[model samples]
Target: AQTVTQSQPEMSVQEAETVTLSCTYDTSESDYYLFWYKQPPSRQMILVIRQEAYKQQNATENRFSVNFQKAAKSFSLKISDSQLGDAAMYFCAYRPGGGGADGLTFGKGTHLIIQP
Candidate 1:
């Protein structure tokens, strides 16, 4: 079994600033995939970034990046130059490698607030 945890239920960051959302997971699988998803007011899950457990480098997509510490089982999201559009419910998710049929295991989510 795998589980993801987001300690902060909500987070706020000023416009043009940066914010980091923390996530930790427990899994027995040796190979897996970690992802950060954003769901805005539209209620659609958007894939922000993804990191493979076997990869040593973190994943990044434009202004969004991840700090993946494999040994620590920690994967945190860093949003740079925060904008109002970035405000949403961020979820950390995990899926096993090798095309496992199991769907993504998600965290409780962190609601991000952008302060202008």
Candidate 2:
């Protein structure tokens, strides 16, 4: 079984600043995928970035990047130059690499607040 944990229930950052959301997972599978997803007020789950456990490099999409520590089983999201649009609920998710019928396992989520 795999589980994802978000230590922070809520986080706040000033506009144009940076914020990091922490996530950790426990999994027995050797190959898996880690992801950060964002849900705005619209309730849409948007993929922010993804990292493969076999890959050494972190995944980045524009100002959104991940710090993936495979050995530590830690995957955190870094949002740089945070904007108003970035204010939302962020969720860390995991999926097996083998691709199964089971859906992604998600964290409890962290609500990000952008302070102007």
lDDT per residue for candidate 2 within 68-100, as digits (tens), equals 998899999999999999999999999998866
lDDT of 1 at 75: 99
lDDT of 1 by residue, 32-98 (tens): 9999999999999999999999999888899999999988999999999999999999999999988
Residue-level lDDT for 52 in candidate 2:
88
The segments of candidate 1 whose C-alpha lies over 4 angstroms from its true place after superposition are none
What TM-scores do the predictions have?
A: 0.97, 0.96
lDDT of each: 0.96, 0.94
Which residue pairs show collisions in model 2? none
CA-only RMSD, every prediction: 0.9, 0.9
Candidate 2, residue 104: the lDDT equals 93
